[model samples]
Target: VLEEIGIIFRDDAEALALWKEAGADVKGERVHFPKGLCRSLLKTAPSIYTQHARNPDRSVQIGGNATVFAPVYGPPFVRDLDGNRRYATIEDFQNFVKLAYMAPSIHHSGGTVCEPVDVPVNKRHLDMIYAHIRYSDKPFMGSVTAPERAEDTVAMAKLVFGDDFVENNTVLTSLINANSPMVFDETMLGALKVYSRHNQACIVTPFILAGAMSPVTVAGTLTQVLAEVLAGASFTQLIRPGAPVLFGTFASSISMQSGAPTFGTPEPSLVSYGAAQLARRLGLPFRTGGSLCASKIPDAQAAYESANTLNSTILAGTNFVLHSAGWLEGGLASCYEKFMMDIDQLGMQQKFCEGVDLSENGQAMDAIRQVGPGSHYLGCDHTQANFQTAFYRSNIADNNSYEQWLAEGEKTAPQRANELARRWLESYEAPHLDPAIDEALKEFIAKKKGSMPDAFT
Candidate 1:
């Protein structure tokens, strides 16, 4: 339906021309980016604001790392918003998101989830993301993986939390049931059921990589995406349809040249757009953005790729735009610089989305009449009173003269971002968990571990 509407992965010559017109540096499947691509693309994005409140504190939030999203500098095992306690770090350029929040992502090593949480806390640079309840602008989503094997899921669970966390959090096995495909074993089914019983908010996904897991063409990718969504939804519905599950649409467009995962290439972006449409069809939220692949530091490439994918997806309205912060290398390694830059990018989005208020009489228009068009709105009363309320800010946004910028130290966005992250870390104090309850929770995990000594090994 979305395709018929002419607003999804457009890969034909015509589409290529369109992307190029949007300032994309297209080379076949690759999309080289130009500055301001995201801001520009968002103008065409097909989503509408869901809601708003008059109160400043009222907000909508979405998508995060269950572990790596945590604050690293806080006291060990700080409880996050989702009720999971874990680590957070700032010293490393790569941050550990909160536990289980980010769909299981591939590490640069092609092994290990994003965090090293299972390892001792002191040595691990783990991070946990805490989320207070809120709505989010990103409405489409794509979950990362849908492994059928029981052992793989059990292993995955252990890596995030200990053996006990599974029972305590009720994050059932990611594996499928015994009556189902052998690919999905009984253990996985049991675990998923357990998670469902608790009504966990998760996006189940059976990942299909083109030229690797599925076919290389768009049709093959679509078929695989459909199958994954079917499997995920089927399982969720049976387990608990009201579990706030989203359709899985995160697919990687593999590099035919290096067989490496491509980032911000038209291939992956296309795949993401495709996934978004499908999820919309299911009327389910999709989780599909964590795309930051340029190796360049807070340079042009990073901005271009991140902004293009972000603006495109936002325009497309993927339910849970993730990796909103701290990501790099095709969404493999988390980069603080990239995360910082993306925050600025989001701020810019906020600026763009400040819906126009066409109130007639006394104010905006009256002020306009008072100033008479181009005489300069900069020095007017209406302008001074509301300029700060109307502008987005960025250190790297090129808003000042070179000489004035030099006078202000000409700092890059990353510098300001790093300082911000550091400041946040320093000023932050972990939310207090009931000490005795926390201890008992730890003891419960220990006892569960004791029940199966062999499970640890």
Candidate 2:
């Protein structure tokens, strides 16, 4: 269907020209890929690649068995610690960056944890990119809202990583979402071109809400997903062969009754599983799934839904998991408590991915022998030795007895998470950026901001 019907490259002449030059059939803005063209082009895209962080210890491997968890992306509203929901500001954005940085289980500092509405729409990208650079040393993403914003992200990165390093290494992994139903608009295409030309990673994602943006059936949705991803990821190779790209998909089922999007459903999980296999067949990194929920608050409904989605994500062998933490209200709001709760689960997921242990200590032969049949192993030497590291302790859960819980004011999980978020932010410290590089970044941002009038829209 892709080869015959073709995908529309709406209003992107440069993209159309490139497609035409690459032997694709270009009719106005629609480009048709030959049956095997996309697959052949994908050969240059590396099956696995490392994304370098400013702090070398925090760098992450993007493919293979590794699964890197990132916080939520593109939420405009924030459910604050005080339980009030409002438009996110740069301060709120920085706070979430700090929380993500402090989260040991969160491997990547996600892009736009929440949209900073207080910052000018035209200039917020600078603040967002800088927040990741200054507040966290983890691998981070770049702007894809506009080509110029993407350029600014690259420029800021060059200041820290050096121009030569930026040109050669995979330092940034930006998201480029397809405008679904088989369309790639100019905004996304331009950003993909800029990032690919510089040898940075771009996750070519097709955002699909089943029954709306895509077919309702999982098999049908997966077909559209593979076609969109093949076309987009292969295009990166066309821009600059060997530029890293991931086969990304964001899927959710919509309520057939009201058309509202739903999360943590079986159909989306099935779509994720199928998409992961398709990505592997193409030898590209797979990106999908998240701790997604549709609940307005961090309640029981949120917990159940997020757990289902997060489990599916890890089981799918996803290479990069976006929205792994802090998502709430169907991706409309980023709740502080939910962010804390999600990371608590992420810690457990990380341990779960390690699989069963067969070592001498893991087998616990000593503990078993010391406590024969009816006796407990609570005070055994082996138990004492390994107790601390034996289990994944959750920071959010109140596992104490009912009496103890009541004595402690009957605090709920969200209450505990709220406290944790506050403590993390209060104790947050900025990562060390060289004074010269910091100054250069500030100058670049200032100059760029001065060049354009502030546009809120």
Candidate 3:
């Protein structure tokens, strides 16, 4: 397919040149790879690698058996505690970052948790990157809207981790979505080049809304997914051999009648499952799945859909899970209630990923023996010892008696989640950053912002 149709590297002369140098048949912007070109280029990609956090204890290992959960990315609007959907602000972005940091199950501080439209288009990336560095010490993603913004992210990362450390380690794992239908635009390619050259990780994903971006069939979508990822991931190797890259697939089934993207559908889950297997076959880390949904609010529809998608992602052996929490309105808005709700579900998924515990304590033979004939185990010695940490307790669930629930205002799940989000924000504290590094980052941001006229567009 690659040889016949060829992938177009639009408006990028350097990318075309690199493909030409690598012996690919470069025809203008349309470059057709030799049959084994992509696969052979993927040989240098690592199967697994560590994305080091500023707090080394928070570092995550991507690929293999590991699965990392990050918050929603690239949302322009947000649903607040008042349940009103509005344009997201810088404050909202920081709050979400703080929530991710506070939530034990959310492994990485996500990029562009919500686009702060109030901030200028050119300058928002600076604030967004700073928020991740300040509010959270978890490994986070870099900007991919532009190559210079991506370069800025690398520079700021250098401030925190030092030049040598930033150069040597994979601190940022940014998202680079393919334009789909076998196309790689200059904007994404430029960012990919900057990140790849610096040895940072890039998730080369095909952002496909099936029936719209690619063929409707799951198999056809998967084929397009593989072709796009191979082209994108392989191109990273051409830029800098062994630069960490994940075979990222974001394939969603669209509503046939309305032509809107639908989430938690069976077909997209199958695509995710198949794509993970394909990534494994190529010896590259797989990235897909999230608590995705099309609902505008965090309701039953959202819950059901997110569960199906998130479950399929974990079961499919996805290494890095983006949008694992806080997605709503088909990625149009980041709902606060949904964020907390998804965090609770993420905790459950984390426990599920541990698999069934088979150790003595996990088996609980003593508890079984103490409560023979299934009389009771609640008051038993083993049960008493393990009660606190025994099961995955949900913060959003109301398991109390009906009367007690009424006394507590008969709050719905969204209500409970709203309260939890409020509590988290109220008690939140920014992670400690070195004063010198913080100052350097501020100066750099100020200088950059001053250099460019605010480009709201």
**Whole-model Cα lDDT per candidate?**
0.43, 0.94, 0.94
Alpha carbon RMSD to native, model 3: 1.0
Q: Cα miss at 104, model 1 (Å)?
A: 24
Q: What number of clashing residue pairs does each candidate have, in the order they appear?
A: 45, 0, 0
Instruction: Flag regions of model 3 displaced more than 4 Å.
Output: none
- In model 3, residue pairs whose N, Cα or C atoms come closer than 3 Å (at least 3 residues apart or on different chains), thus clashing, are none
Compute each candidate's TM-score over C-alphas: 0.61, 0.99, 0.98
Cα error, candidate 1, residue 55 (Å): 16
Can you write out model 1's per-residue Cα lDDT over 1-457, one digit (the tens) per residue? 1111111211335434555665556665333445444333323212211111112122123222111111111122222222233443332312232211221121111112244344433222111111110111111111112322222333333443356644343332121212111122333334454445444444445455567766788776776665545443444544454544545455556778888765566666777778778766555656665535544355677777777666766666655544554455554445544554565566566455545665653248757777995697788778877777666656435577999879988887666666655554455443333455345444544554455333212
User: Is candidate 1 or 3 superior in TM-score?
Assistant: 3
Which is better, 1 or 2, measured by lDDT? Answer: 2
Q: What is the lDDT of candidate 1?
A: 0.43
Expressed as tens digits, the lDDT of each residue in 320-396 for candidate 3 is 99999999999999999999999999999888778888999989898888899949887999989989988999989
